[model samples]
Structure formats: structure tokens, C-alpha cells
Target chain A: MARRGDELMEFSGSISTLEELHALSLMVHEVASDWGISEKVLFEVSLIVEEFCSNSVKYGGIPVGVGIKLADSVITIMITDSGKPFDPTEVAVPDVTLPLEERKAGGLGIHFVNHFADTIVYSRENGRNILKIEKKI
Target chain B: MLINTSQKENLQIVSIEGRLDSLTAPELELWIRDNLASPEFDVVMDFSNLDYISSAGLRVMLNLSKAAARYSRKFSVCQAQDHIREVFEISGFDSFIPLCDSLDDVLAL
Candidate 1:
């Protein structure tokens, strides 16, 4: 867990465990609220968190971990999982024009994060898949 | 979220309200399992008042559609608000999940 500055909460992510996702999302909401983010921003953040965490569980391999960091006028989330080294950033965006039956669930989650986050980064290091997203308050 | 179901003729309508995120998606999953596992009937969902939907919701709906397809059952969505409709559109659910103008439309189909 990256508990350096303004730590909120830390939890372990095991296979089929969603408790950490819920707790981290709540913490993100609280930190965003504290930073005076708009209601619209909060809504968007909520959606983004749901998308990201869902992907981590549905796609990521093992042992997912989420960390929240609050700083001057910004809130950030770092999600690391030992999943099958998937870089969501690399996945092609899905064609929404396609009918639901034809369209696949490719970039829905990453697209939401990209649209909502002020900055997003994905990296694979030391056998860990790291996803960092930040939103300006 | 809790699902309450009622049937009229061959239409099995399930009305879902409240939040439908990851935490609650499982409950909906159970509801579908207990009620919709059989392939004998079509299914209609009334999400006119659902506040939130996440990827989990999408997964559940997708699985349901797959089950319906395997059993040759029809699936429809009725009375979704504009915002909810937007989600359906954004997630490309409008293609596979039939959207009826009203319950009558669903029942008629």
C-alpha cells in the first residue's frame, strides 16, 4: 500500500474479494468531497471507480490493492493488481455504434477512466499491473 | 438492490429500483438465478427508477441475455428514463436488449 501522504484506508484484494473496492471507493468519495469537488465531478468519479475496480476484479489476476492519496487540490487513486499483466490503456476502444450483441466489453472501463480522470497512467513493473488515476479538485 | 417479480401471460416482468453497483449486482444475480434460470418464458425489466448502474450491472444483463438466447426467450427493457437510456446506449445495450416504449409494447412483443 502506498501510504505516504494523507492516507485514507488500506485493504488487501484477494480473489473474488470486493470489500476493498467498496472501501477504497468510499474513501475516494470522501477525499474528493473534502477537496470541494463539484457534485457532477463526484458522480463521474463514482462511475469511474466502479468501472476500474470492476475491471480489476473481472480481469486482473491475483491480489489487487487500492490506495488513495490526497494532496493540494487533487485526489488520486493507485490500483495495483497481480493480474495477467493487462494494460487497459492499450485495449482498443469499443465501437459503440455496434449493436450490443456484437460489441465487446473492451475499453468501457478504461474509457470511463480516461474521460473522467485529469490524468491516467498504466504501467507493468515487477510483475504488478499498476493503474494510477488523478482528478483535479 | 432487491428484485420483485410478477408474471402476466408469457411475460415475466422484474421491477428493479435502488442502486445496482458491484455490491448489489450479486443480489440481482441470485434473483435471476432463482427466477430466470428456466428457458420457458421471455423476460422484461422495469428500470424506470434505478439510480445507479455499473459494470456489474452490465455483466448481469449480458449473462441474462445469453441465457435467454440459449433458451430462445425474449428480453425487453421498459420505461427507462432518459439518463438510464443513455447508459443503455453508451454501453451498447440498446442493441441486444429490446427497448419498448411502454409495458404494453413489451407485452405485445
Candidate 2:
């Protein structure tokens, strides 16, 4: 963990496998717990990390870098991957109101991320796909 | 994650323990396909011991629910922790998958 400024505490690393995603989940949980964040926020953060990191490893076909920063009442998650230039924000949100038979499982992860995160932004920079998400605690 | 399966009357009670994310979702999918391949599709997934789940797990459950519907079989989930339940609700899974308060409730259904 590194202190970026007077109020920001940051943790960043690269993960290459699904097992590393689990480790990342544990690390984020421990850090959030140590910071005394609420369990609800912790759950959201855990799911967010899992969804993003797994998507990167499964689809990006390259090592993914994750950065988590906690400052005051907000937590920011940033994911960068060198695999492809895909922007999740451009995808359409699934129709969650559809009945079971008509529902499709694809895109729900990104939908959940969009719902849970207070704000999200995506961009391609220097051949890396970057996604930044923020949530208020 | 660990899956413990047992026969309960007409239902196959599956108790899942630990996290269900992208890494373990495939295992659950394979287990469902292999173990629950029978024509009798009445199944109850007991989530009392499950600590966490991600969208991957939700997708698996959705597929299971759809499979049961296609076969005209019963499927339900019971005893989900509050956080887990919230995940289901957030994703609108509770709308289609019958959520039971207890194993007996699912068995009775």
C-alpha cells in the first residue's frame, strides 16, 4: 500500500490468473476491513474486483493491473489490461426485468458493475484498456 | 468451493460452501451437468454456508433455473445469507428463482 496524498491510501498490483483474482479479493477485503469500511461496501467492492479482474483474465488474454484507492468517503477501482481495446461502458445494459426464459447471462457482470459503481469511465491509452470505477462508502 | 450433495425425497439438495466466482463457476456448472443429469430435476441449492458469490455464480444459477424450467422440474434456493440474498435481488434473480426461507420450505414446494 502506498499513500498518494494526505488522504488517499492506494494498493496496486498485476494479476495473471484466476487464482490471483481470489488473492486480490482477499487483499481488498483485508484492506477494507482494516480501514473499518462497512460490510455492505466490502461486499460490493469484492464483487466488483472479482467481476473486473476475471473479465480481464478470461477475455483480455494478458496480465491485468489493478489499483484500489480509498480516500475519505469514496473508494476508487482502476483496472488496466494490455490485451484488447474493449470499453465495457459502451455495451448496452441488460434488460433485467425480462423473465427467466428470455434472459441471457452474458453482460450481467458489466451491468452489475454499472449499477454498483457511483461512476465509471473507460479509455484506451498506450495500447492498454483502462477502466476506472468509483463508489461512495 | 465445496459442494455436498444429498438426496432429500424428490429433491437433490446441494449445499455449497466458500466463494463462487469466475474461478469456481465452471466447477459448479460441471457438477450440475454431471450430477443432476437425471430426468428428475427437482433441486434445492442450500446457500446457508456460502460465504460469497459473483456474477459468474449468478449466471450458473440462471442457467440451472432455465434448465429446470425447460425440463418442467422444480428449482429453488434456500437459506441465503443477507449479503448473498442482496446479490440475487440486485440482479433480479429473485424474480424468477424461487427463494425459500428454509430447506423444508423448498421440500414442501
Candidate 3:
């Protein structure tokens, strides 16, 4: 984790185990609180971080890196994964308009990412999947 | 997370406090499996003090709601934050599971 003079706080690392997610969660909460983020935004950021990284840690078995930057009331989230090239934006979104009995479980996390984020961009560079999510505070 | 169970009138109220993420969601799920016997008592999940919930948490609640339907038990959620309610709405949980604004609202159902 690197803290600069600017409001941007950058953290990038690899975790071999799932326990690291909790540590990451604590770090996220502490940073958000230090920056005086709203409860709702912080919660959204937490969810976004968890869902993105969990897929890598639990499914892809690859190391994940996260970056959080705050500038002008806009929070930017960057996630880099060394796992098998996967694109969250391409995931088939479950029909949220469906009734309860017809609803399915898959893609809800990506659905959440889309709803909470103002914009999302996915790319692949040098065998890494980079996902950038931006949210307005 | 703090789960306090109590009886209110005839409904069994289960208040969940703190973050309900993957790390803590299973405890609540196991508690429900071990404690609540469906079809006998109506269930109310109070989220007044819950600060966070991820998809894992939502999955558990959906299981409870589905079980309620399977056994013909009344299950409702109360006191969710606006953002949380939005989550339920986005996931289509509000259609089958009632997201009440308050305990009184739940009682009225």
C-alpha cells in the first residue's frame, strides 16, 4: 500500500489465501473512514471490492490487486487480476425484472457492480484483467 | 455480528447488527437452520443496526425467504437502510420478501 500527498491511496498486492480478504476489508473501511466517505458509498465500495476479488481468490486462484483513488468527490476503483483472463462486463446478467421464483443467482455481483458504479471499463493487457470502476460521491 | 432473538406480539423478531458479509454470513445461516423451525412462527429480520451486506448475505436471506414459502411461514425484513433496500430491489428480493420500513410496518403485514 502506498499513500501519497494527494488524496489517492494505492494498494496493490497478491494474496494466497482467503483470510487476506478480511484484512483488505479492514484496510478499505479504515481508509474510507479516514477520508470521510459516506456510509452508503463506503458500503458500495466494500461490496465492489469483495465481489471482484472474491471471484479471483475463490474461483480463479489468482492474485488480485486493488487501487482506490479519490479526486474531486469522485472515487475510482481499479482491480488487476493475474488469473485466467475473465471479463466481468461480458457476464450474462440475470434478468432482475423477473419474479422471485424465476430469478437466478448468477451475475448478481456484476449486477451490483453496474448499479453502484457510474462507469466500468474492462481490459486485458499482458495476461492480466484490469477492471476500472468509477463512482461519484 | 449481533443476532438478538425475541418475541414481539406473535412474531419472532431476529435483529441483525453489524456487517453481514461473507465472513459473518454463515453464522447467521447456521443459526437459522438450528433455531428457527418454520411453519410454526412468523419470522422478522430486523436490519436497523446492520451496516453492511454483500451478495453472500443476500443469498442467505433469500434462502430463508424461500424456506418460508416452502413451509408456509410468514417472513419479512424490517429496518433496512435505503441502500440496502435498493439492493433488495435490484436483486428482485422485494417482490417476494417484504422490505418493511419499520417493525410497525411489518406488523401491519
Residues B1-109 of candidate 1 have per-residue lDDT tens digits of 6677788888888989876778888989988898789857899888876756666777688788878887889988888766556666667778788877788899887
DockQ per candidate: 0.37, 0.76, 0.58
For candidate 3, lDDT tens digit of each residue in A7-118? 5555455554557876787778887788778778888998998878878777663678888877777788888877788888888878878765676667888889988999
By summed lDDT, the worst window of 10 consecutive residues in model 1 chain A runs over A7-16
- The prediction achieving the highest DockQ against the true structure is 2
| Candidate 2 global CA lDDT score | 0.86
Candidates arranged by lDDT, highest first: 2, 3, 1
Classified by CAPRI criteria, candidate 3 counts as medium
- Candidates 2 and 3, the one with greater lDDT: 2
Determine which window of 10 residues in candidate 3 chain A has minimal summed lDDT.
A1-10
lDDT of 2 by residue, A1-137 (tens): 43444534777888999999888888888877877688778888888878888988988957899988887678999999998788888877778888998998888888888878999889899999999999988
For model 2, residues B1-109, the per-residue Cα lDDT tens digits are 9999888788888999988989888999999899776538498899999988998999999999988888888989999988989878888889988889998899788
lDDT of 1 by residue, A24-75 (tens): 5666666656655665666666777677767778778756766655556566
DockQ of 1: 0.37
How accurate locally, in lDDT, is each candidate?
0.72, 0.86, 0.82
| Prediction RMSDs, each to the true structure | 5.0, 2.3, 2.5
Whose lDDT is higher: candidate 1's or candidate 3's? 3
